[model samples]
Target: MGVAYSVGEVDHLYTFFVQWSPNIYRKRNNKSSSEKDMATKKTVSNSKASKKWEIITVKDSKRRLSLCSSVDSEAEEYQEEDDALPVLSDHSQLLDDHHLLKLAAHMPPRTRGYRWHLVYSTAIHGSSLKTLYRNMAGLDSPVLLVIKDVQKKVFGAFSSDPFKVSKYCYGTGETFLFSFNPDFQQYRWSGENSYFVSGNLESLQIGGGGDGFALWLDADLYHGASFSCPTFKNAPLSTHEDFIIQDVEVWTVQS
Candidate 1:
């Protein structure tokens, strides 16, 4: 028999986005029908993930994507394998889809050329933000938070630190915000890294740790206060043009 698994694996793992889709995960979240309906309504009104995020899967060396969260899909688990095995996959085309998740054509100089590497995505094996945070906690890498407002304006922040739940902090001022305005076909990033974190952070009921990184678009900036990083000294998230976050994603930067 041919080797059960073993193909091309990246010599390096980079920062990547794990596209989380709320639509595909509710089925297994153990919510009542009515609760799910309410959640569905809330998600629809606030998130575009179901409509935009493509379904992703972690695969084996045979190029078979796993429907389960088995160890084979985890690159980190494969690091112990013998040498010269790059871990090839027939799913290489799927790799290109990372482009759709790009926050900007170019990352800030401070970012030092980091990319969003897929890790704990919601579309796979019922993963969600709760899972994302749990998986991300150990890595402690910088993260890029992307939010799509109800107005269709896509913007985000690059936090110098990984996300964590807190009632009182969002990290140091090593963060900045960016906007991807399709209407203007322009990308905008704030000028400095003065943004920080402040306020109550709850674990997400569906996914994630509900840490301060969580977004409640409807709440006032400082009240929900997951983030304190404002582009300007006075322009808190509440006053930003895209104040209402319809959907959100967190990408861990590898380098």
Candidate 2:
């Protein structure tokens, strides 16, 4: 969800252009007939909303790219309000502007405009897995779990659903692991198994295959492990398979 801007607050709305491929999320977020029509018309019509954004689609024939341009108006006077940067929660210890930009590029379109709310952080909350679970109790939106290891490597997972203690793993394919070893790399589902994420009192696990997990955090929230898993086909997330957690944070991806 975007920040609601009143009409008189801004004169011109700049367009937000996103380059995407149709087949990238083929199995997820299937488009409905109405959505197809909206794409064909190159506009997203929300008559009920007080502020309407017109989405213009530009196709790149050579690359078959789908470019979305969302603009409120084409007025000459440009305003910075419409293009406000994502508002990070207060005193984030893990994320910086560069990291946020890279992660946002791969995030789902619906979550583009909203601010990220810091729901849990070891820096704020105590370093306990139960405390992390308690913080995410009833959240229904997507969550980004970031971890910094003792070696100073930053990595984590993006949960399509909020983390919960469940007997059976529960999350959509949108759940994926990511690592930033100076450079950012994300691992999406490989369709090998449905074990996207599972949480228990003892541990939290993301991805599973070959008797190993893509990412695992123990109950203390101090010990962590990463391995190559069939679910995401991802390599170890840390410098080593086993790592000591320096800090952890969970941010709700508002939409």
Candidate 3:
């Protein structure tokens, strides 16, 4: 079935679409043939096909969810019993799966809903730490923060609490900054979200705050500093731009 639009709407759409378009329009039976060539360059990309699905069944006397991905009308599991997980070329896809699995591990066994799902992703929210924190306020769930450096390396951490302001702002060592590739490095929480890299040691990290979580990279302001508490303050900086705030997602139990 084709979409049905009113004659007035069709005309309005046509005129509005090509107003600033630079492409040459050709007439074929009174219709421009260039509509099919739209969206040539990708603004956003995802490795997993949109046609994803999940199902739960009784197996081994335990409930387990079977995730299915579509390829040429053929369905395949994300994690196969006999085969290892496929390495996705797209960072977004790889990150998405990692985030989901990280959250799911803390949730119910094969039941779903104990961990966080993507409520706020910087990829869609844009690159403002303040704005990112502002959008994530008041969600009652543990937060996970991830960042992709200009080095093209991906890393982040998991917080045990929701992003918010407390009467007291201090570190509880409940956050861990971890790497997703090359080296799986995870900094043990120092029992406080506040700390200093100390003595010319460069740092890259993230954490929760009075407002929300901070996603930053190598910042000069905190370069070789000393502090009394654990904190995630340095902004993300890369060789070119600051740091890429790759993603921020909340993990919550489904009530």
Candidate with maximal lDDT = 2
lDDT of model 1, residue 250:
63
Query: Candidate 1: what lDDT?
Result: 0.43
lDDT of 3 by residue, 1-255 (tens): 889999999998877766645353324422433443333322122224433645545683252222222342243343331133223222342365554455344322333423235544546655444454455577655555555554565655565554443444323455555555553444555544453221111333344443423443333322111111235442322233244433333333333
| Cα displacement (Å) at residue 224, model 1 | 8.7
Q: Lowest summed-lDDT stretch of 10 residues in model 3? A: 220-229
Give per-residue CA lDDT, model 2, range 1-255, as digits (tens). 779876754433312211254354442446565577777666434443525555544544423332222233333123433343468867689888768877877777778889899999998888999989998998899999999999999999999999889999899888888899989999999998999999999999999966789999999999999999899999899999999999999989775
- Model 3: how far residue 239 lies from native, Å: 11
Total backbone clashes of model 1?
Answer: 26
Model 3 TM-score, 2 decimals: 0.39
Q: CA RMSD for every model?
A: 36.5, 29.3, 28.9
In terms of lDDT, model 3 sits at 0.42
Q: Tell how far residue 214 is off in model 2, in angstroms.
A: 0.4
| lDDT agreement with native, every candidate | 0.43, 0.83, 0.42
Residue pairs clashing in model 2 are 1-255
